[model samples]
Target chain A: MSGILHIAGLGPGDDALVTPEVTEALAQATDVIGYIPYVARVAPRDGLTLHPSDNRVELDRATHALQLAQAGARVVVVSSGDPGVFAMASAVFEAVEREPAFESVDIRVLPGITAMLAAAARLGAPLGHDFCAINLSDNLKPWAMVEHRLRMAARADFAMAFYNPRSKSRPHQFAEALDILRAECGPDRLITFARAVTTPEEAFNTVTLGEATPEMADMRTVVIVGNSATRRVGRYVYTPRSAV
Target chain B: MSGILHIAGLGPGDDALVTPEVTEALAQATDVIGYIPYVARVAPRDGLTLHPSDNRVELDRATHALQLAQAGARVVVVSSGDPGVFAMASAVFEAVEREPAFESVDIRVLPGITAMLAAAARLGAPLGHDFCAINLSDNLKPWAMVEHRLRMAARADFAMAFYNPRSKSRPHQFAEALDILRAECGPDRLITFARAVTTPEEAFNTVTLGEATPEMADMRTVVIVGNSATRRVGRYVYTPRSAV
Candidate 1:
């Protein structure tokens, strides 16, 4: 029997948001692998085995999924958001590159509703204009690079979305990010902090760059900074389609 | 009877990619309003009325939807991709801002698998790292601003996604944009043109910056330019998650 490896996105912690393509992949998988919380999102079945690992072990997890697929096990690697966006898809490809034998494995990346878009939907189109999505973790890239991108994005007048904005390990960096934004985007720019979007724990807050504090964001939060044209319309905040 | 408005995404033209949330919204919609093609995607039913309008009339269509909703009609405004991403969600809010009487209208924006994300999935994660999405259409924004954002995005080394890269009215501008991209991103950079993604007529081509021409893209295409680290892994193109 030929085995397949599918890197699937569970889509911001909502069952309704998960695409039928991904749901169909999960139903057909013999083994499901992912970070603990994501893997736990999958229901246990008679023939399916779940392999949940700790965070930051993405490479190892990808390798294991590849090995399982090589052994004729239909494997699915899951990520919280779209696997292609700061998630499992690239890691799987990196593994395939490291081991050329895995290159021939049937791999497909399934897209889903990413956090930034989900947050934007809830906040009334804060990213409705030109935008950029930056992963602010600083684990993979330097803090300097993030700051540089932030400044460039501001100068370009693009609305921005930040993933992994603040964590216990990197407490001070988000503050630094906020400082950079205040300097570049100025005090009046609107910013939205959407925590645990689309789930029961979902919370949304929109504030100005001057009013925003780093503590408002956590690891679960996705922060959006609007372009110069973004503003409040009734209870919602949105950037106009036209630019100045 | 209270009225409601839902701005929903149809997910890059695939039945399977459309989320259950969006499907449920369609089922309950008393009227569906959008550009011709998008409105045609919704099936005809006894209670549902489809209002198809021509392109470049976003504001007019949005106001009509608001009017219908205010008249106690459940309206769903459809966009081909996520409504919040260069689509109808912001247009709807812009209408709301213009008329304060519509403030009481209940509005919700449902997310969908946007063209860029769907294209990235098919291309094996070209946007696996930091990225920006720009609408190259000069209809709303000035060409100089588009050029400036291209330079800034290239300088920041973010993977880039272009929406409405070329249209019959503005043919030469995309060539100029490509010229700027080549100058900023270098000749060796990789670019992918994904036409009609997730649809039956889907076509994907990955070429170097030197080889890409303006004709590779049209209104239906979503263009992706990879970061410096992006390279070929087997038949796929992907950017590694890590930065230098």
Candidate 2:
């Protein structure tokens, strides 16, 4: 039996936000692998094995999926948002690069509604203009690099979306990020914190850079720093199509 | 009859890519409004009126939707990709900001798979790292702003996704933009042109910055320029998770 691996995105926390393609992939999968929460999202049924791994063990998880697929298990690697964005697609490809034998494995990356887009939709179109998406987790990269990108994005007047901000292990970094934004984008620029987006526990708050506090965000939050042109229209915040 | 407006994304021409939320919005819509092509994507139904307008009249179309919604019609404004990204969501909000009488209209922006993410998934995560999305059309913004942002994104070593990169009226601008990218990112940088992504006529091609010509892209294409760490693994091009 030939095996294929599908790296699929579950799309934020909403079932309605998930694409039909991902649904079809999950339906056809004999094995599903991902973080505990993501794997738990898949319904359990006969002939399907679920493998839920711990966080930060992405490489090991990817390798396990690869091995399972090689053994003729139709595997689907699940991610909360778009698999390509700071998620499992990169990890799977990284594994393939390290293991030449897995290079020939049939792999497909499915796209989904990323957290930033979902958060942006909840708060109006804050990313309507040019924007940048940065994974603020310092696990794979340096804080200095994040700072540099934030400065450059601000200078370019691009709205910014930050993922994995203000985790319990790295709470102070988000404060530093806020400081950099205040310095580069000024205090009045709109900043949005969307926690548990598209879920039942979802909460959205919009504040200016000066009014924002690091305590307002957590690992579950996706932060959106609006461009210079972003402002409130009635109760909604949106960046205009034209440049400031 | 309370009026409402739903700005929805059709997700790059694939019916499978259209989220259930957006599909439900379309189904409940009393009137579907957008550019001729996007409106054509929505099926014609007995109660739903299709208002297909010409291109470049986003504000007028937005106004029409607002007016219809104010008249107690359930209006759905459709865009090809995510409405928040260089699409109609901002236009509708801009109209809201301009006309206070329509401020009470209940409007919700539903997210979908943006072209860049779809293209990145197809090309195996070229935007796996930090990235910027810019609309290279110079229709609303000046060419200088696009050039400046391009330089900044390159200097920050961010992967870049460009929307509306070329058109018949501004053919030379894309060539000029390519030259800027070549200068800032160096000639060896990988660039992917994904045209009509996720559609039946979809096409994808990857080339080095030095080899990419302006003619390779058109209005339908979403162009992705890889970061310094981006490279080919087998037939796929992906930006590494770790910074170099």
State the lDDT at B42 in candidate 1.
95
Model 1 residue A180 CA deviation in Å: 0.7
Distance (Å) between predicted and true CA of B226, model 2? 0.5
lDDT of 2 by residue, A35-121 (tens): 999999999999999999999999999999999988888999999999999999998989999998998788999899999999999
**Candidate 1: residue B96 lDDT (0-100):** 95
Displacement of the residue A70 alpha carbon in candidate 1, Å: 1.6
Off by over 4 Å in 1: none
Scanning candidate 2 chain B in windows of ten residues, the lowest lDDT window is B235-244
Tens digits of per-residue lDDT for model 1, B1-244: 7799999999999888999999999999999999999999999999999999999899999999999999999999999989999999999999999999999999999999999999999989899999999999988888999999999999999999999999999999999999999999889999999999999999999999999999999989999999999999988889999987
lDDT of 2 by residue, B1-244 (tens): 6799999999998899999999999989999999999999998989999999999999999999999999999999999889999999999999999999889999999999999999999889899999999999999999999999999999999999999999999989999999999999899999999999988889999999999999999999999999999999998899989996
Error of 2 at B170 (Å): 0.7
Clashing pairs in 2: none
Backbone clash count for every predicted candidate, in the order shown: 0, 0
lDDT score at residue A3, model 2, on the 0-100 scale:
93
* Chain A TM-score of prediction number 2: 0.99
Candidate 2 scores a C-alpha RMSD against the true structure in Å of 0.8
DockQ of candidate 2 is 0.91
